[model samples]
Target: MTTLVTDTGHPVITAWSAVSPYGIGRDAYAAGLRERRGTVTGLGPEHGTTPDGVGCVVPGFGVREVLGKKGTRSMDRVTGLAVTAVGALLDDAERNRAVGTGEGAAFTLGTTTGSAQSMMDFTRDSLTGEQPFFVDPARFPNTVMNCAAGQSAIWYQLKGPNATIAGGRAAGLHALNYARRLLGSGRARTVLCGAAEEFSPARAWLEHRCLDGTDSADSAEGAVPPLGEGCAMLLVEPRAPEDAGQPVLAEILAVELGVVLDGADPRPALVTCLRSALHRAGATPADVAAVARSGAPGRAGGAETEAVHEVLGTAGPADLTPAPLIGDTGAAAAAFQAAALLAFAADRPQQAAGRIGVITSVDRTGSVGCALLRLR
Candidate 1:
């Protein structure tokens, strides 16, 4: 296992995150964390207003700004979020590199709905209006699963292996694991790894099918996920103690992924995944300082996670449903959790040693993934 540290003398988290409901930056995120405030609120009709009052929307930067004017015309909303996030991560690395160049940067992106909006838009247009022959061919490329990863590499001039994975909620954690493996196998000098999800009207509709949308339901009491949107990126390197912009927040100790069939509880596989990750990291449940759970502020996911904690007997130190504040950013959920854990460690460095922050994700397809992280 490797213990990564940032340049600021904290454990090496290297390059980390940026997330918000209102285009707020890292400082704002820190403030929200400190205040325990929820970023979710009702977006007015100026944007895409929903019948339901709650939403997590990005405040600033539109598609045109995130992707260039020409690029924006061809990209979907989710692609826009991914490009912006990956750009921020690469920029962070460029500004803080103590040793190597950015040419060797690798990328692994995760997402559940890569271009659902695009598909929905095209379908609606076809049914409502005359057939349009002038459809832009460039836009078609962005509809594929790997489009975000490909676009990010093209934008940043990265020449390393590019990968995309999606197994519902496990997507982000799985992507991180892929990047970690690349570094460990000496395949790349550095990696840009993360996930991004875009909120769509369809998502809310899907939730209605699985959950009851009522005022009385606590955020966690809803039957389905409270879908939201955001992006998070991490820069991983093989070497430790590089002169990066920030101190090390934590190291990537271990990662594990497991598959369970539909209707299976997944608790067993999840527990095994966690135990395997801890064992690989040479740690135990007691070594974990906090658990950054990918709970969606809904009952099914939360109950399953709670059951896992019960089995492990380690629920007290973990933070439950932190995503309710920012909303569930699809593929970015686990990556966001990873970033949050690192930031939390950085703020409380004295208490971070030997304390591993565990990130867990369970996909609707019954796949489970766990990542074990610790400060150096």
Candidate 2:
């Protein structure tokens, strides 16, 4: 069997990603990277009733405008974001003919809270016996963990093997790995790979309950790990050089997953994961130019990432917590980081030549995943 990196059949990232943060897009994201602009802002209540306190709020591009009225109503805000991002990806691909009818395209969506807000809302309405809240049965399909991927495929009219993986924060990278496998195995011609996470009171409550109150701070300011919202999509194809109009972002050098026990020190596991990813990519620590990390700002998560950096001797070029601008986007965090890496490579100095970009993530379950993206 050929190594994941050397398969030559390796999938290339073509048209990918439209991030929504304070009205940001590829251009704004690129500008932010070029100018080092930090867009992290405070978040108000989910319904916009509460005063703005703290957190990264997505600006620009409402879901209805992209997905249309019917599509928007069928999805929660998080899924709506995912659909919009994927829509952007497909639109780019369609313009270049990289995607077409019967092109055998697939989708892999990663997410943590799949319609949790919808469920919560439905539950509240049912508790009050308010006519069962008039939930559309058609939307029931989107209530599950894999709903994002399924909806993406339906929305884009892609027909191929599709799956969804939820490894918490690592879910996004895991989805990339899955897409790579499908392309490498000749299972599909093109794959739309992406991840999405929607912020919900239930999720925030749970995270707060899990985190040490001391480290927990409002998300608006430059707090280490602020809650974030958004979705990102990447179009992956088996061909290395296709006629796709969008610029080739980066080549997927290698991806690996490592699981640590519930109470074990994550440092060792993370180190092992990073080392394996680099080895598989035939790269060394020195070969990496930057590290795009989860940077959740959780005490353990932050400490564990720092320990990994110390092991690799990669001191500070790391893009820890893009949340200072994008906030923590749950499963989309890593994918967003991946998008950031693409943006970074698109404009960074050539001094980064021969240097690969590494994306790493750790979930609450103690699973760590790392992907090595080589700038081509």
Candidate 3:
């Protein structure tokens, strides 16, 4: 693999933070990964439609602790999670000068829906009300799919380009793809890219049904686990020769995408995507020290595993699954997997730094992609 650090256009993750099941910052999440412990909690029928399930939930998170009273009054869980994660990321990156006044800051996020709860509630209120006039105008904005990204921009005064993607499990990389294009064209100096998902009854029920519908005999019976919630944000900045001395978290070599048409095999698409990503990074499967990734259980899951093994030799210890530990994070899955790789490199530098890593994902809707990254 090519090992030079400077004179390349690769974007490096300068700073990152999260409000995950582990806690309010990346430290807690890192600790959880190191201990091989997942922070998911059991959710019985009382919590949602599932007879039995689990979820990676943040227990007793006080909003006032992160955002003042003014910020908590009119927020939904998705917005709260996004705002909280962005606040921590800005604080950690100390990008106030560049991002605070809407100077050169760009923001992008991924989400399935703005907030399932917000949309369902708003729609229900409209239909159940005596008339359309009875709907709450104040709550209308929360139903927009771009609410989180727009809210984050407004909260931080980021005036640069702000966008949101409707990517499912591929959301994180979708944001990365957009950020790369924006930055590559000199549209922005830096971009905060990530994805968020909030656990809700509507989301939980939908996921249960989706898992139940997966008829690919490869699944572990009908025992669909649980879902996870939270946001993962990364401060992606352009790499420069002079900034090489700074502590570089990870340099993104490339972001690759693939699609498997309906009623077709996904293994071919996945293999082609992985091969292209490695080739672009001037590396091969052997150069990838570890793969921080996971996939859906049935056919998608089986395809992902077979592709990795067929291309990378073996699925051995080098393969890591953050899902079993964190449950299924849906839109936030890719971001968390990327974070897991960075966390391993940071917390165990001696073993992980200077090594190439990749985060591969295969969403339910035939969307598949991987981000090639190297920790400095």
Clashes of each: 13, 10, 0
Q: What is the C-alpha lDDT profile of model 2 across 207-261, one tens digit per residue? A: 6566655345554221445566777777776655545454556778888888888
- Best of the two (1, 2) by lDDT: 2
**lDDT score, candidate 1:** 0.68
lDDT of each: 0.68, 0.69, 0.78
Give the CA lDDT, 0 to 100, for residue 367 in model 3.
88
TM-scores, all candidates, are 0.85, 0.87, 0.91
**Two-way lDDT contest, 2 vs 3, winner:** 3
Candidate 2 local distance difference test against the native:
0.69
lDDT of 1 by residue, 141-209 (tens): 766878888887787777777899875677888888788777666566677788888776765555445
Candidate 3 per-residue C-alpha lDDT over 1-376 given as tens digits, one digit per residue, 9 for 90 to 100: 2222222488788777888888888888888888998676776554455434667786656556567788566677888889888888777645433443366688999888879888998989989999967998878888999988888888988877899997888899999888888777777777889999988888877775666456335346223446788899888777766854444789999899887777577788888988998889998776777787655556677777778788787843266668777777889988888888888788767767777888888877888888888876
TM-score of 2: 0.87
Candidate ordering by TM-score (highest first): 3, 2, 1
Better of 2 and 3 by TM-score: 3
For candidate 3, the TM-score is 0.91
List residue ranges in candidate 2 displaced over 4 A.
1-7, 22-24, 44-52, 93-97, 130-139, 213-224, 241-247, 316-321
